[model samples]
Target chain A: MRTLVLVFHPDLEGASRANKALVRAARELPDDTVTVRDVYALYPDGVIDVAAEQRLVEAHDRIVMEFPLYWYSAPALLKEWEDKVLAFGWAYGPGGEALAGKEIAVVTTAGGPESEYVEEDGGATMREVLSPYRMMARYTHAVWKEPFVVFESMELSDEALVTTGRKYQAFLTD
Target chain B: MRTLVLVFHPDLEGASRANKALVRAARELPDDTVTVRDVYALYPDGVIDVAAEQRLVEAHDRIVMEFPLYWYSAPALLKEWEDKVLAFGWAYGPGGEALAGKEIAVVTTAGGPESEYVEEDGGATMREVLSPYRMMARYTHAVWKEPFVVFESMELSDEALVTTGRKYQAFLTD
Candidate 1:
């Protein structure tokens, strides 16, 4: 299946460790089954080309939104892309069948440890935090896949990063 | 209490009914008690003025983020504003104390009904869907009140809208 990886990092080339590694591994695949688009590079001014984004979605069988979880969500540019690209009559409401049968997934990295996300641990669970994306999948009638998350990303070792990267590549293919 | 209402609707005057009503009600309050800001109008090109937004937040004792739920989350501009304005070392991280002890609330309208937002019902719970904002509140050391949501917004009656507006004003104060 053709997978579209929509990457949303404000500084992918600078300051990103885990996500950068993941991207590199995803790109190393030779089959051309995956395509990566860095959103910040595409729209530095934050203006999204809605039709073009829709066309990309139409061309892909599975859609992956990859990002570093900033302030418990994706970066501002991805949010802008979603609001503009996913229009009323095209992505939802009447006659909105653009993403009816596609598969959707989220790949995100978080600064905090996984244990901190539990209710009693003074943090939200990953499932809770990612509910918006899950709901979006449901709304669009897209197949929702289990998310690929990297917790405690700030402290991940280089060896672990490469391991995670390989796992992420396998996830895209699976 | 001084309250700042940051309105994040793409077309507040044209496409939004519930949001417009809420804005009108919030604005009708005494100027000394409340301030209404149309964020989209302020930044038509989706470019956020970080300094200006930070100043607005600092000026208010209570901050209410008002938006129509898009993709089961806040509209893109609101997320952009949050990501940009709530920067590290300012909103969180080391020496980030700008929002400490403040109160933050989300006043949102959803197209879907309340009954639809449950795990068993194939919908995400309201609390789960909005956990990102809740987590932001936690990270910023702000008090997070229960979010004020108007589900089935499209079906709301004129009387309900007015009532919701009045309750919203009360929510701002209390």
Candidate 2:
């Protein structure tokens, strides 16, 4: 399947380790199958090109959003992209069948450990935190796939980062 | 308690009705007790003044983030405000006790009716959708108050809007 990975890190190059590594792995995939775009770098001024973004979605079979979990949500730019790019009569509502039957997924990195995101731990599960995206996919008539998350991302060793990258690449192609 | 209302509407004057009415009611209150700020109007360029926003939080005992629910979350500018303004030293993390004992609440307007937000209806409840804000309040040591939501906001009559406004004003003061 043709996959498009939209990376939405505010600082993908700086102050990021796992996300950068994930992008590098995505880039290594064959261009015919995978395309990666850094959203913040493209929209430093926060003005989105709605038509172009819609066109990208139209061309891809599976759309993957990559970002670091911030305040239990996607970065501000991703929300801006959604509010602008996914307009009414295009992504949802009547005559908004552009994303119908397509697959949508999320790949996120969190600084906290996986154990912290449990009921007994007084934290929310990654799935619960990402319910908005899943609901968005449902609203747009897209299939919501299980998310791929990398936990304890802030302190990963170089070897662990490479392993995670390989696993992410497999997840994307699977 | 001193309450600060940060309204984040992209077009407050043009495309808003209920929010505008609510702001008008808020303005009628005593200036010393209620402070209202239109976030999008203040940051048309999307470049938030982090220091100033933090100071606003510090000056108030309660903060009410007022916005129309866009894609089941706050407007992009509100997320930007949180990402930049709620910094490590001032909002959370070490030495980030500025917001401790403060109260945080959300007042959101939705185009959909209240009945649509039910599990049996294949929809997410408002409480589940708003879990992020509750968690953010928890993380920051800020008290999480029940959200005030205006349902079917797009179709409210003038009388209904005024009623909602007055009730919202009471909610703020109480």
Candidate 3:
């Protein structure tokens, strides 16, 4: 399956560590089946290319969105991409079955640990935090894959980071 | 309480009907206790003024995030505001208490009806869709008010729109 990874870090070069490592693992896939796009770098000004994005979505069998979960949601660029690129007539609405049979997945890192994302603690679980994305996949008739989440992202050891990368590569090919 | 209503619709003037009415209702308050700012218009280039936004958050007793739900969440600018303005030192971490003891609320309009938000139907409920905001409130030590959601926003009748606006005005204060 051709998998498209849309990385939505505001600054993958300067700020991100987990996302950067994750991208390297994605790039290690030795074929044309995996295409990685740093979405934020492509639109520094935050203006997304709707048609080009639509074409990319159409060409991919599996679409994966990679980002650091900021303030309990994906970065601003991912939302911007949804607001602009996931046009009503193209992604949903009548005759908009572009994602009808595709696989949709999310790979995100959270600075906080798993203990924080619970009802008794933060008013939501990690699964609840990701409900919006799941909703999007359901609305578009796409098959949703269980997300890969890296908790305590700011404190990952060097060894754990490498292990995480290997697991992520497996997730991509799965 | 001094309520800051930050409206995050990309095109509130031309592209939005529900948000336009909601803003008008917010404007109808007899005094200055309710302040409405068109956030998207303020940041046309998507460049948020972090310092300015923090100052505004500090100045208010209640912050109401008003927006049209695009793809099951607030507009991109709201996430941008969180990503940039809600900085580590101010909104969370050691000395971060900008939102502490303050009221954080969301007022959003959904194009779909209330039925679509059910877990059995759309894979999530409306309350689940708003979990991220609740989590943000929890993280920042803020008080999360029950959100005011407008369902079937795109298909509301003229009378229903007016009623929704009037209800929104009341929600701003309560």
RMSD score of candidate 1 (Å): 1.6
Off by over 4 Å in 1: none
Show the lowest summed lDDT stretch of 10 residues, model 3 chain A. A114-123
Q: Ranking under DockQ, best-scoring first?
A: 3, 1, 2
TM-score of the second chain of model 3 compared to its true counterpart: 0.96
Clashes of each: 1, 0, 0
| B33-60: candidate 1 lDDT, tens digit per residue | 9999999999998878899889889999
Clashing pairs in 2: none
Q: How much of the true contact map at the interface does candidate 3 reproduce, as a fraction?
A: 0.86
For residues A9-77, what per-residue lDDT tens digits would candidate 1 score against the true structure? 989989899889988988887646998888898888887888899999999999999999988899877
Q: Which stretches of candidate 3 lie over 4 Å from their true place?
A: none
Which of the predicted structures, 1 or 3, would earn the higher DockQ when compared with the native? 3
> Can you give the lDDT of residue A45 in candidate 3?
85
Note the B-chain TM-score for every model: 0.97, 0.98, 0.96
**Residue-wise C-alpha lDDT for candidate 2, range B48-137, written one tens digit per residue:** 999888888999999999999888888899888888988898888889988789999999999999987886644678877887787788
- Sort the candidates on lDDT, descending order: 3, 2, 1
User: What is the C-alpha lDDT profile of model 3 across A24-136, one tens digit per residue?
Assistant: 88999976889999998998888888999999999999999999999899999999898888888888889989999999999999998898877884479888899999988
